[model samples]
Target chain A: MGILEVKDVGKRFGGLQALGDVNLSVKENTCHAIIGPNGAGKSTLLNCLVGKLIPDTGSVMFDGQSVLGRSPHEINQMGISRVFQTPEIFGDLTVMENMMIPLFAKRDGSYRLHAIKSVMNERQLREEAEQMLEEVNMLDKRHMHSASMSRGDKRRLEMAMCLIQRPKLLLLDEPTAGMARADTNNTIDLLKEIKEKRDITIAIIEHDMHVVFSLADRITVLAQGTPLVEDAPENIKGHPKVQEAYLGEAH
Target chain B: MFGLDKKDSTLLILVAVLTLLAPFILNPFPSDSGLAQFNAGYPDLMQRFVIFGIFAIGFNILFGLTGYLSFGHAAFLGVGSYSAVWMFKLLSMNILPAIILSVIISGLFALVIGFVSLRRSGIYFSILTLAFAQMSFALAYSVLTPITNGETGLQIALDDPRIFGGAVAADGSIPVTNLFGLEMRSAFDMAVGPWSFTFSAGYYVCAIVMLIAFYLAIRIFRSPFGMMLRAIKSNQTRMNYTGLNPKPYTLAAFVISGMYAGLAGGLMASMDPLAGAERMQWTASGEVVLMTILGGAGTLIGPVLGAGAIKYMENIFSKINDNVLHGWFAFLPDGMEDAVVWILHPFVGKGWHLTLGIIFMLVVIFLPGGLVEGGQRIARAFKGKKAKETSEKATTEPAE
Candidate 1:
């Protein structure tokens, strides 16, 4: 069985079918990319996997546990973290403080009632968060406000925020959507390094073909809320249906 | 980052020392000396300073952290005052039970309101709190009049049976509040040089409670719950997705803030031995909100400054009349004196609202972060123009 599996998922928003009959599996210790055109339900699918939106009919299993009915925090506790398409770092909190939030959740198991203590003084969590920030090349910026960072740095900080929990599966929604070309290349390299170093599964949704082609071990093309093709990147590049459904339209 | 800096500590110590030596400081420019007419350290006004300081601190919990603008916190205050008064009437004029009962009752009240109001966030939640507070006011005015004492308010009575303490004096007065049989109004008088200072036990009691409340607020401000509330304010959707429910955290904050309000209310009733329905009015609620906003809603010291500034203005503005105005312009030429009176004439009596209104507008417009932000700006300006270089470096650094 795959480490993360989506079995025949179907979702609707009122009369509009956001996703239909989607089946995908992410293997352990591999990067799987989901590439699609706009309105192809890529984001919607990511939402369902992270427990943001419940599928109308489907089963999502992470590490053999059904995540369909769990709250987002509960799913996070089950070791799956998602980086939003936008840089969703807590802007007002210092970069160090923002990272401490997830570390607190990770160490305390999602929800904690302890309202005392300097969170930064928690030796174990602080070390872990600092280590993660260092890994993301953000240690130098740890004292700065997250809001003050460039868009690329914000995304990088957000990524570190997710990784600190050491989730079994990390979901990325267009991680480089708004980044400059140089920043995008840097992010691709960072993801590649992280994938190579960690025994973690990754499922990413991306609009940029370059990022998908560069990092994905296997790529799935989603069109009109359904999977058009799922195969190795090189094979997907030449698929006739994928060409007609996405690239042809893009060109 | 919000840690108490040296300036803050110094200001606090100054305020404390000044409060401790108020009899001298307040009387320095007495009206009889042909100087300022305001004697701010008078017992009644000083009592207001500490009491309202407590109220604004509690208010900062909800408004500052979560950014939920409540318009009905005064209702909680009123409820607490009423409960404290009842404690004095039935139990003893001991403040401990009254304060405890007030806090618990206010917590329960806040729970019900928070449970319902938190279902809808932002402006809707604010309106819901307002509606509930208005309903509470209406009930206190009419439906619950027997218990709340209607417009006359709740007060200690000599005719009532005192279960714990003996009956009140023939003047229909209960004894002044006591702490373990020690009279709260008992005073110590000290004389130095040309000044005599009176320190009342009641002020000490209020001051100690205010300190504890302030400490608890500072704790809550730095707590994990505080971070969660700030997260909610920053981004609710992201918080939900991060696997924590916003409702429970917000509800807890609301309840805590409500208890603080209750404590403040109970303190007020304990000091005066009366609880009026007007305490729960919308305008009263609006005053704390104003105080919190005027000081700097999210900052720890902001609300206290806001409360102090507002209360100081209230003490000064309410006392200004045509005679006082004429006194200021007594040295002016006749036409100028008349012009000054004309200029200041309409802004007295109930017209005190106009002064407050203008101040509120100015604060909100020019100083969005309130007096706290203004202070930071001033400090930043005085530090010199070179700080912008450091700010550039600061922005590049990731704060995590």
Candidate 2:
């Protein structure tokens, strides 16, 4: 059985059917990519998995536990961490401080009052954050404010934040969206390095075919809220149905 | 010391020194001098300075750290005052029990108010708190008259059944609020080198309490809980996604600040032995807000400075009659003197609020970080000039 199982999930928003009878399973320790045209419900499906949106009919199981009806923080506590399309690092805080938050969350669960102790004196947490910054080549910028960093640096800091938790499943929603070619290649290399270094399962939703082909072990093509095809990268590239869905009918 | 870092310890020490020597520091002029009118060494005004400082410090914890602008905090203050007055009427003339009871009662009131108001965020949260405070004010004025003593206010009466101590003193007068056997009104007067200073028991007690409150606030600011509150302020959505619930943290901050306001209210009643419905009015709430913002909302010393500045101006400016204004501008020709007083008249005395309003506007507009930022800017400018001078000297010395 796969680590993540989506069983006939469906969602509707007013008069529009955002998702209808979507079913997919992602095996453990592999990079899975969901690609589709605009308005094809990739984000809606990701949102449902993360508990941001409740599916009207279906269950999302992560390790035999239902992710539905749980808060985003609860889902995160259950070893699921997501990277937003636009990096959501704490702007007013330093890069090291931003890294420490997830570490704190991972160690103390979702909500523990560490009120009396000074955060500056948390030697262990600070060391862990420094280690993570070094891994991302952002150790020099650790003292710099997160908001002052470039777009690429912000995305790297966000990835470092998520990775510090060592989440069982890392969900990336268009992780390389709106990036220059160099940054995009750098992100692909980082993902590759992460996959080789850690035992993590990645589920990424992307519109960039290059990003998908470069990182995804298995590819799922979604069309208008339904899974059109699920196959290996080689099979998906030549699939007749996938071509039609992307390029539309020629005649 | 006091679980504070070096900078915070220094700040606490500074505040302590300032408060302890207030009678000396505040009374800079000789007793018989014309400028003695500006001396703020009297017990009544000094008590207010420290009490309001505590109130602003607490407000800063919530609004400064969490970015939750509560408009009904004065309700907690009123609740504390009412509870303290009731304690004095029933328990004893000692201020200890009254102060403790006020803090606890106000904390509970804050819990209920915070629980309800925290369900909504942003402008809705503010409105909910405001509505709740208004309701409390109305109830104190009319509905809860028996407990609050209505418009005349709750005061010590001759027939009050003081269980711990006698209701009346040996002189057949209502008993005064005291700590142990020392009365709150007791003062020591000293005269040296043409200067006279009066130190009162009540002001010292309040000053000590304010110092403790300020110390605790410094600890809280350095704590991890404070970081979480700041995280919530920076971005609640990010906080939630990072596995932290913003609601509980924000609620805790709100309640803590409320208790601070309550403590201030209790101290006010302890010093004067009176509790009035007007204490909980919306304008009182606004005054605390103004104090917090005008001083510097997020900085540790900003709120206290703001509170002291406002209270000092209120006391000093309101005392400036037309006669005093004329005395200052006496050097000018008679016609120009009249023009000067005429221009400044509306901004002094009864028009002191107009001056305050103008100052508040300027601070908000130019110094959004409040007086603290303004201070920082001036300090930075001086530092920059010194650095430039040193650099120029170094460059010239190499050539010489």
Please provide, for model 1 over B1-400, each residue's C-alpha lDDT reduced to its tens digit, 9 standing for 90 to 100: 2444455456556656765565566656544444555656556666777788898998899989988888889989999999998888888878999999999999899999888888988899899999989899999999999999999988887765667776675465657788787677787766655444567777777877876677667667767778888887887766765666777888888998898899989989988889988999998999999999999999887887888788878887788888888888899999999998988887774478788889889999999999988999999887756677678678878773
> Residue A184 deviation, candidate 2, in Å?
1.1
Error of 2 at B361 (Å): 1.1
Model 2 alpha-carbon drift over 4 Å, by segment: A247-251
After superposing candidate 1, which stretches have Cα over 4 Å from the reference? B1-27, B169-173, B188-196, B385-400
Model 2 lDDT vs. the true structure?
Answer: 0.92
- All models, DockQ values? 0.47, 0.72
Candidate 2, B1-400: lDDT as tens digits: 7677788889899999999999999999999888999999899999999999999999999999998889999999999999999999999989999999999999999999999999998899999999999999999999899999899999999999989887889999998999998899999999997898998999999999999999888878878788888888887777777877788888889889999999999999999999999999999999999999999998999999999999999999899999999999999999999999999999999999999999999999999999999999999999999999999999999999
Candidate 1 local lDDT, residue B294: 94
The complex in candidate 1 yields a DockQ of 0.47
Q: Write the per-residue lDDT of candidate 2 for residues A1-251, one digit (tens) a residue.
A: 78999999999999999999999999999999999888989999999999899999988999899999999999998888899999987888888788888888888877777767888798999999999999999999989988999999999998998999999999999999999999999999999999999999999999888999999999999999999999999999889999999746333
- In TM-score terms, candidate 1 sits at 0.93
| Candidate 1: RMSD to truth | 4.7
Top lDDT model: 2
lDDT per prediction?
0.84, 0.92
Q: Which 10 consecutive residues of model 1 chain B have the lowest summed lDDT? A: B1-10
Each candidate's fnat: 0.49, 0.61
